[model samples]
Target: MSSLLRIVRFTRSLAPLYTAIIIASVLTSVAALAVPFLIGHATDTVAGALAGETPTGTAVRAVVLIAAAVLLAEIANTVISNVGGWFGDVMSNRMRTILSVRYYDKLLHLPQRWFDSEITGTIVARLNRSITEVTNFMKMMSNSFASMLITTLAVLTISAWYAWPLTVLLLIVFPVYVWLTSLTSVKWQKLEAQKNEQVDIASGRFAEVVGQIRVVKSFVRERGELEDFSRRFRSTDATTRAQSSHWHRMDVIRRAFLNLVFFAIYVIIFVRTVQGAFTLGEMVLLIQLMTMAKAPVESMSWVIDSAQRAIAGSRDYFRVMETPVDPRTAAMMAARPEGSRDGEADGAAGSAAALVRSVPGAPVVAFRGVDFAYEDGEDVLRGIDFELARGEKIALVSESGGGKSTIVNLLLGLYEPSAGSIEVAGHPSAEVPLDQLRSRIGVVFQDASLFSGTIAENIAYGRPEASEQEIVEAARRANADAFIRRFAGGYEQVIGERGLKLSGGQRQRIAVARAMLKDAPVLVLDEATSALDTKAEIQVQKGLDELMAGRTSLIIAHRLSTIAEVDRIITLRDGVIDEIGSPAQLAASGGIYAQLLDLQSSGDTRRLARYDITA
Candidate 1:
């Protein structure tokens, strides 16, 4: 969509404020023009007195009136500008809020692959620029452009009253100014685009270095990283200088022609005054009016440049808004009943709450003849068929890239199978509303992704309306209550970003508590304790047991011992199920599971069963 249209639509949302700003803008413009006219009248009165045609008293009264008019005009302009500035600030704040919410919603629904390919800092840079553009565009429309338009019209009309020929001459000059600016602005716009690209690159570089500071330090690569950053900085600096240099050259050309036009108007006025075609008062008035018109004319270049930047930034904003969200999630959103909060399914977290309350019992999860692949890639999972009966627990074991996590992702609807189908609670997974589907399942990942908030807040993430009592109970069940209480603030203790202030075990316990609070019918634990030490692992395992108990559980583990107690184990090879049996049964069969166990156990099944082994 066009940037102006987007800005106008945003303004319409807060019409009363913009309306007041518009009224103020017009008044300010009129008052601004009136000052010049008062000055011209004062000059004419003094000239008449000097020529002995007007009395000194009359000139003094004119000077007093001019002073009063100047004071009033300046006061009106100040008050109106203050009001317009307030409106601009309010509009800017609202636009930022609305755009941020939309961007967040888009991020939530975007495919994981998009994130894999895009840098977080680049997205942040785009959002920042886009929001600034939107706000500035509103300010321009309400104040700067409005004032210029009104003053231009008033100046031309008053000029015509003095001399129609001069008005005609101005009309001819104005379009040429606009046309030349438009032509020159195209190059500046291209430079602006390049400058924006450099900003994205520089932002990405900074984000990467900061995000991986530990890695850089550990590898003693600080110098190399700094050198890379220097390169990016230099490139960005060069682009900025190039853009500034081009703009300077264009400004000189524009100002030269504008000044020449102003001089030509002065010569015409002086000649007309000498020819007796215009009086001294008319000459003074025309000159002042022409001066008023000069400002708007000269400002045309600024208007074009700002508009172009806003247009470019708005296009970036819309690109995210227009990106396609996952179809299942979209369907759930569309199916929201009337009065649904934010048009989200159920309400804020209502889907999960309702799902758990309605059915506390386990829900069956099934995958039949499922074949999957990444976009433009070969199959990662083929002819996969499995079912976790209600309240049953199953383990998945395979090589690093052996479609183990792919299975979990497919069941969670993070990816669609190339062929076949998935079912939950006896309904086609694709047909089930995403809200209902997700709310019925809970998961813990290899890395516990935690937000920056209080401990209680993180625990209640899945169910925001969960009470303090419920949150405490869930934490206790997950073995997180002890550490939480150890902190000075207890439940209110702030956890830093991604729970970095907490250890691996602490973070995992919090994640388990979150899942428990959700009370989902099915549980999937993906390498939940893989990163912890023995002592931490034991603690986290207790929490896992509480979460998985009585739920249809799907467990994927790199450490075979972690899943030793599961009712059944499924082994995958080359994207297909190779074997399915109990751990003891697999050991007896002497297959892939047995081989993995031997690799870890030094050839004794008894010792291997107790020893941690890669699967």
Candidate 2:
């Protein structure tokens, strides 16, 4: 079903509450109708009493009782509308919460290729609008829609009972009113959709400019950036203005039509009264009922328009919701292995495979003859094979785009290999549960994306259950404790967004501390020390050395210095392994490694000496 119909159907599911409110609301309308009827009856009777007919006590008594009934009806109307609004809000909030959680769950289970294909801003846009759209729909349904439907039904029923011909005339005109309203809605919905698309485009441009603000300022490209953003902003504003015009035009047309319709109703009623078909008192009742109905009829057109816009907004969100998630059933056998004595299990993996990894003894991560390509013919990784034993430390060194980070992501099961299979501890990577797999691994990235939060919270990010003392210990391990203590509130100090309040080195060290606190059996250090200062780099390297001592580790590095100390170096070029050997062995081979050592060692041509990494 279409989203508009679905929203309405879902609303109907809360029929018990709404039906009760509607029943009360209709009764209130009936009582209100009686007030005008009583006045008409009293008017006709007073004329009779004045014309020397016996004074009718019953008519006076009827008028007094109807007045009391009108007072009661006003209270009932208020009570019903408020209760309906509360129930609708409750249901809307429930739906929003459910959808929000499902989105995150689906996100984690999605294959790496899917995430790589979509922009981050687009995903954000889907989520941010879901709750807003649901809330808007609730307000429209229970408030504007409920009142109009009840009042409209009441008016038509009363008119039919008193004057069948007039009722039929009014009923016939409603269909035309509805058709015109739909026309306005169609025009407005197109504009609304266009406006939403423009916002997404503008947001993407803003994200790019702000993300690269440092480079823009340092290279004096701020003016160019501003110009690019201005161009995007102009497009956004143009679409917004066009959409605004459509809505305003619709508002004017709908209101004018309702007014014209109202005039026609009155002209018909007046002519009938002059012909003596109805008394003067009956004419007054007709005028009073129509007067009360003008608001709902006019407002109904706008409600229909809003319903269309809400449906358009919900389309993207529901599509994301409907996307399938990976079952990962094949990996279940290795998902959770029983811990052996001393928390170490026997592994079929090699010695260098175990360092800086999460799962002990048995390999927590591996890539076996893994081959990949963005497309069918263009292979990126050719039969790549590796295994991380429970506590092995390994480094991948290569030129730019050499597939070092790709290997790291494969271990994380972000992407499945196209030609070969990868297993985490002898199980197919795709078979393991996503959250469990992630919880077993921790990563320290080059850029070190830190959020605005307390130093303690940042340090304990991976392990939110970490105690205050544990957070402090992890910070001390990365040489971050001294600087953190210097902050005004120490662990309580809040870092600005993306940790802008902290130095680059400080943020990098804190990120390392977070990984350390996780105490995962696997660690992916992707250029972890590439962004730090010399002193901070030394401190971070020391922490990494300790972190790698007993877990599987994969280091993706551009800097030649970081690769010299690994148990073995896997050198890559153009996504293929160039050579794999110890630093001494590769240097002796006098191939790629020897040439690299020659360039990075002093300005001399001789047997190379490795840098003394004090950290």
Candidate 3:
């Protein structure tokens, strides 16, 4: 219920439009109600004429006037109802836009850890289902609720005026029917929630399977995937059957009570009219009013069903919206100047510069006693410490699961260390605004991670404001300009998803160009060229070398030969720094780096396997 109220409050911004819809609905209801009174008057006129107590000419005129009035009322009702519906459509779409934008914005501010535990498909599915249900429910209520309430109230009032006893009988139907429906509310909602979970899981898996169709086909798991999908939906189907049976059984009881109440009212009305206790026209008017009142009662089940769905949907929506955003990121976002492009806040830059000036000769990047562990897990990195001077290049070499990537992730503020602290550009990483901090560093991952867009768009992604000449220059430096120009569209050519249309080298070069365009003071290469063949690696490495010039570079390399040119090598063993020294110094030091080099030179696959390194 609270969730439903919160959804209603979201409409406060469009109150004027919503108010107009309600006003139009009320007017349409009034017009529709006029028909019953006009019909009753015409019936009395005809009755008087039949009794020969009134002139036929007068009766004919009265009937004609009443019939004309009824026609005009109906026309007005139709026009007003249509206008109100238009407003409802506009408001509902606007509501959807509002909700979608806010949801996306919240997602942006959420921490990476929040996303780490969630599936891409499930996240997207929740947004679609929740928003659709909420908007549809709002639109339906806007179009019909006001009119229903008005008609119900008008019918009851007019009935009471004609005969108090019949109105009392009709009133009894509402509470009794509502009470019966209430009996199923808790259990019905429980079943509905269970069903929604199964449906969400099925929908989430469907999206995942489609997105990874290539993998599924390669593994020949089509039958298995289909069976799993079918099994999930079968769970939903069983739950739905239970939910329906419960609702209809209760509905039967409610409907039976309503029929009995109406039966008594009808019998009394007919008997009184035959006994001359009521006029013929009064009896007709009373019966029509009673029917009008019954219409809302009959549709109550549908209204409640829709309302419950909306409530459940809204509960899911608010669950995400209400999750606390990462406070550090939130503060950074709030501090950013409005209308500024990403990471271009002049004030933030000035503050960062001031901190640098105050701490002269600070390391470009540093880690001090850093320790980290994932949620409820043992430390992946422990008592780690290192520093990168300005314009220095350092390589990190380690076996698998040695926390090499975790170090980079912490530097990027993706995760906070469980113990100790890190500093970047002379300021504590936590103290620096995220945009400003990230703006100073550029990263190219093992995967190119390119989106489907023009080659120019991918190159200019980090700096969207880069000029055409600048983009071309960056691409040339990355050795991507040649292949890009080979395409008929040149730089304007669109790359397929994740740059699948291009070779490994081509995609990596585009990523390099993007990093080049960013031109930050610091760069990170996370095994950027390891996926390519010898010739491709050589071609991509040239661009990487150019990008690394005159900047602080942190390299994570699995191949021993690739780090020969690095000024220093840091080797990790079991989450602690095993050796740190110049590449030549470590080669002769007979440490992990030296041992790995020996193993590589000897081509001893078994020994290399012990170190978790591939030759």
Candidate 4:
């Protein structure tokens, strides 16, 4: 009931359309009732004329009037039906648009944790199915129920005027129908909920298989995947059958009981007519009224069915919208630190020296005693503290699970620290609005994810409003301009999904170009060149150097060669900084950095020896 009310409240703007629909439907239904009465009157007058009890001219006029009324009723029904249909379609589409926008907006604000835990397929299926059901429910309520209710009432009122006994019996039967509907509705809702869950499971499986087709092919698991999907489909089909059977049984029972009562009413009216208490025309009127009453009673089942599905879908949809949003996305926009230039912390061209010159010794980013843990998981970071001075280049080198990426996640405001705090440009990271903070930082990840679009479009993703000249300059700076121009369509060449049409190094350079276009004050490269061959790495490394030149940069790399020239190196172990110094200082100190360097050199030597033997 609450969900239904919520849907109504959401569509309050459509109240005028609803009013128009109901008014047209009521008029149409009222006009239709007059047809039966018109026929009854014509019958009695024609019978009297045939029996010589009435004038033939008067009977002809009555027949003509009845025909005209029937014609007018049919025309009115058509026009009103059209009007009501138009209102319903417009209302359904409008509600769909409103709900779709709200669903996406809520997703943007919802906690990242929810995204991590939920299945993409299931979420999308629920979103689409629920909106459809909700729209259908609203349409039926306006177009069908309005007419049904009005017809039922108008018929009953006319019956009462003719004979009170028949009307009273009908009024008594109406409550039984209502009571039966109420009794079955709860069970119907429960069945629908279960059916929907089965659909969600099947949807999730289909999405998973399609998205990972390559992996399945590589593993030769196509047969297994098909079997799994078939099993889920069978389960969904079974649930659907159960739901349908329950609905059919309830409908059958409701119809049988109503028909029995209607037969009893018919018998009473027939006997009354036979005893001369009612005329043949009056008997016909009673029968017509009974038929009209029966229609709405039967229609009650359909209305409730749509209502149940809608209510169930709405409950799930509302759950998502009502979930708590990520705190970072919810943060209000904050002012730039006092005395900082408008583009000082926002431009990639702003060199570290310029930043230090403006505010000496102040860090562009700082983390103080930060600690973090995943839900029900071990601590990933503990009492970790670090700072990147304005205009300085730093590298974080660590084994897997050393909390390097965790720090980046915290700095980006993707997650909150369990304890302590992080500051960016003298403002708390948690306090700065997420979009504003991210706009000031550029990141190039190892995987280099891309959508299916032209090279220019992908490059301009970070700053969609970037001018052509700006795009060209950024591409040139990232060393991607030359290769992009070689394509048949130049920058307009369509890249396949995730830029899979391009080589790994080409994709990486495109990602770098995107970051270059963003031109943020801070840059983070997470193993950006680690996945490339030697030749590719050399090419991508140059682009990285150009991108990092003027910004305060943080490089996360397992390859020691990549971090050799950074201003400082921070080595992490077991969720805390194990060493921090310049590369030369750490090497001379014979610390973790020096040992790792020697180990890599030894491994390279063995690789060369093996290559010589193969040659």
Give the top-scoring candidate (TM-score). 3
For 366-472, candidate 2 gives per-residue lDDT tens digits of 67788988745587788787666666667786656668788877777676678778777666766555555666778998888998989898898888999998999
lDDT (Cα atoms) of all candidates against the true structure: 0.79, 0.69, 0.85, 0.80
TM-score for each candidate, following the candidate numbering: 0.91, 0.83, 0.93, 0.90
* Ordering by TM-score: 3, 1, 4, 2
Determine which window of 10 residues in candidate 1 has minimal summed lDDT.
339-348
Comparing 1 and 3 on TM-score, the stronger one:
3
Residue pairs in clash, model 3: none
Candidate 1 on 99-177: residue-level lDDT in tens?
6665666677676667767888888888888778876876776667777888888888888887777788789779988
Give the winner by TM-score: 3 or 4: 3
TM-score of 3: 0.93
User: Higher-TM-score candidate among 2 and 4?
Assistant: 4
Clashing pairs in 4: 348-519, 352-391
**Candidate 2 — worst ten consecutive residues by lDDT sum?**
340-349
Candidate 2 regions exceeding 4 Å error are: 8-35, 42-68, 86-122, 184-187, 207-233, 236-264, 292-294, 329-364, 375-377, 559-561, 602-615
Please give the RMSD of candidate 2 to the true structure.
7.5
Error of 4 at 311 (Å): 1.0
